[model samples]
Target: MVTPELNGGDVGVGVGGGSFDFQRYLSARADAVNDALDRAMPRGFPERLCESMRYSVLAGGKRVRPVLALAACELVGGDAAAATPVACAVEMIHTMSLIHDDMPCMDDDALRRGRPSNHVAFGEFTALLAGDALHALAFEHVARGCGDHGVPADRTLRAVAELGSASGTGGVAAGQVADKESEGLPVSLAMLEYIHVHKTARLLEAAAVSGAIVGGGADAEVERVRRYARCVGLLFQVVDDVLDMTSTSEQLGKTAGKDVEADKATYPKLLGVDKAREYAADLLAMAEAELDGFDAERAAPLRHLARFIAYRQH
Candidate 1:
């Protein structure tokens, strides 16, 4: 496990000094993730199910998770190209979570990324199957792509282990369960933290650590990346809360105000919109501090990314 001290270094402030173009990095990495998905997916499946998965997975988002993975790899002196597979894997897993989260049995979201959600577009059964398929495909893609790149078997295995651990009971799944239970119930701040940390932060941490592991980061740097991910992960949730109350469904491309409607516990609900925004900023600063030892240039995308998360309307 990554230590808390490593996670809590100097807080990052100001725009990153790195030359990395956030737009270019996001676009290029998203394209690579798409290409990897195309290459890794089966050529023939139930065509309809395939289409359903494609529809949602290919939907536009910032692809922030994959970008983080790639950046962490590069900062560790690892080849970005070699990390592409894992980056794609992170996206696949993220997509899978979205599919499941949108289920009627889950969040019951009707839209995603500015379009009808997978369950709404495709049937609930198909959406469920697609989510399952994507979950399996994530591991398959990572293992095959990493093997093709000659990543050591042990490291590749470690990446898989990390992904599973973060997405399972100790991580994302637990958060989901907590989220479901917390609705309509008065939840304490600690409970809210538990949900966000496990549900959102775990996978974000996994994405960063997976990239570092596959890219061959030293243990120390891997720990630092994990810390960075945690700060950003919590910030991501806080901004999400702020956006839900402030952004339109059209702007967010998802069901907005669902948290309030469902009486789900959210930072904004607890702290109000302005305070939630302030909290997000604080988390971003901490994340930046975690990356201070690296050249400012190397961590620019991450710094801007945190800011983007804090202020994003959608």
Candidate 2:
């Protein structure tokens, strides 16, 4: 769905307008992600490892993280093209996490986004290497992408720092550890908060913040976008928990009901499906509200993106 501004000249097709297809935006974003992926690959990386990275990285999911980054960059008047490398890097990191998370030692699922898990398709050792390779490559892409941008050296350094903290031990890694320990146990809300905030929200916050930095958003704007991102990040997970309870495997492209199977604590389990859905809606609303002072035209995509996160069945 396209988010119409409260008031403005919307020169193009938007959600309900003449020819503005939301799918067009999705297509453009997907193409951008793929192009960035091609640019970010290492020249001499092993052909086999490159093939596996490509296998998952190009596996054709929604490209949500990259979209979020691009949307944030656009909202701040940055060239979406300039943000492509960082977008692709963040997505690579995300995909790598998924690969490792699905290993027998981790979430142990046989399916992902609707196909055999990476570990299932490649041997566990190869999958392990692929995941590790992608992780290192993510940082490499960030450094290279930032360097190519001609951004001020200081700004580039800040961007790299933000990305590092978000994906490193204090962020996604910490969340992963918490998730591993929570299985089959009745998790406290505090622990669940740790998992969602660090594991899920951290990367999202990084995406938005990086977008602003690359776009040269003023300090205030960067902070605002980060706040918006935090709300949406948690909202994303809430919707995920809700979908896990209600969506079918065909819709989700992965094993549904596996949360129950694994006894993983989720919002639906902790707060009930109805309440979780409501919470997701509220968080999205908060995210939109945070953008109230932004240039409405520029922020339209981000607003729509926030709503899309909550409503997306997949």
Candidate 3:
């Protein structure tokens, strides 16, 4: 596999004294991730099922989770190639979640990434099966890819465990269940935090921490990465809530203000939009602080990533 360039030099001066070019970093890693994903899943005997899985998995998005994995690996002096499997695994899990999240039993949305949702494009049963397939494939790919790439078996096992935990009741599933149960009901800020922390933050935390583990980070270093990821994960949702309230449907590429429409609990609803924005800023600060002990240059990508999540409009 071709190694991705992790250097910031190609993008010229970065923000705040030319340390890193976040946009370039994001673009490069995203391209690499897309390529890896395309190569990872191929058409199989059950053409329709494979196609359905590929359709949603290949659908465009920011590729943030995979990039986080790669960046975390790079930060710990690991080769980007070593983290590719985990990166792809995270995207697969994310795609699976999206497929399920848009199903009739869930959010029941028809649009995703500016296109028809998985269930709309494919039949509901097929879409559901597709998600299940991808979920299983994520772990399979991680195990096989890590072993093939010569990552230590122990590290690979740890990564697998992290991904599994993040996908199951302790993570996305738990959050989704709570979110569905809480819809159109009076929900407190604590409950809202619980839902987002589990639904959104846990997987991201897994991505970052798994990368560090696979990258051979020390225990203390892994903990720091986890804290940073947790903050950024929350920051991601807070910013999403703010954008849902402030941005246009066109700019967002999906329904805007739908949280309010659905009577769902969001940071903006609980804290007020201004306060939600303030909370996002706080999360960003806390996330960046976690990186202060690392090499400044190596930590630049993560720092900018936190800012990106905090300030992104969509």
Candidate 4:
């Protein structure tokens, strides 16, 4: 396994000093991931099911989760390509969550990625089944991807476990349920955090950790990356809450003020926009601190990513 000292040498943050082209880097990685997703998606007996799954999977968000997986792999000195399976798997799980979350029973969102939600584009039942299929496909992709790419069985198993927990009760499901229960109810700061951490942070943690594992990172390296991703995950949601109030549908690509309409407890709702912004800044700083030990160049992508999430208009 790779160790910390061996991860990389002293380096500068790639953003301001080293001239890392973040947009180019993101585009390249996202293109690779999108292509892989297309290739991996099943096109079989149920044509509509396949279409529905593809609809959301290809809907085009930031692809932050999968990109984080790939970046974490490289940060630990592993081949970025070697972690593609885990990266793709994480995206699939994320996509499935988006699909299910947009259904009538859950968040009941109609717009996603600036387009009609899966349930809106397709029938509700088909959208539900497509989500279930994507969830199952995510695991299968990892197992098969490992075999196809020559990753060790132990590493593959560990990645699988990380993903399972991230998508299961301990992660997204738990968070979603708590969020639903807390809707229109007074939510404590601690309770709001619990909701986001489980619902949002855990999957991001799993993504980075799984990528590190598949890329053969030492345990310590994996855990450190997990911490960093957890901060980013919470930052993502906080930014979302702020944006919901500030941006419009034209900018956000989804129903703006949806949180307000739902009477949900959001950072801006409880903490006020300024305080929420301050909290996001604090989270960004903490996230960057977690990368201090790594080669600065290697950690630049993640650093910029934190900033990107914090300052993004959309």
Best by lDDT: 3
Q: Which regions of candidate 2 are displaced past 4 Å? A: 1-21, 42-45
lDDT of 3: 0.88
Order candidates by TM-score, high to low. 3, 4, 1, 2
Task: Estimate the overall C-alpha local distance difference test score of candidate 2.
Answer: 0.81
In the range 237-275, model 3's lDDT, one tens digit per residue, is 888887888878888888788888888999988888878
Q: With candidate 1 superimposed using the best TM-score fit, by how many Å does residue 110's alpha carbon deviate from the native?
A: 1.4
Number of the candidate with higher TM-score, 1 or 4: 4
Which residue pairs show collisions in model 4?
A: none
Give lDDT: candidate 3, residue 7: 22
- TM-score per candidate: 0.92, 0.91, 0.94, 0.94
lDDT of 1 by residue, 192-243 (tens): 9999999998898898899889889889989999999999889888878877
Write the residue-wise lDDT of candidate 2 on 1-314 in tens digits: 21212111232345222354455676788787887787676555677677778888888887878888888888888888767777887888898889998999988989997889888888898899999999888877777667677666677678778888988886898899999898988899889988998999889889888878888889999999999999989988887887788878998999998887888999989988777777776897789898998877777777777776766757
Task: Candidate 2: give the clashing pairs.
Answer: 13-20, 114-253
Off by over 4 Å in 1: 1-19
Candidate 4 residue 69 Cα shift, in angstroms, is 0.3
Looking at candidate 3, the ten consecutive residues that score lowest on lDDT are 1-10
Off by over 4 Å in 3: 1-17
Residues 212-260 of candidate 4 have per-residue lDDT tens digits of 8988889888888998999999988998898899889998898999999
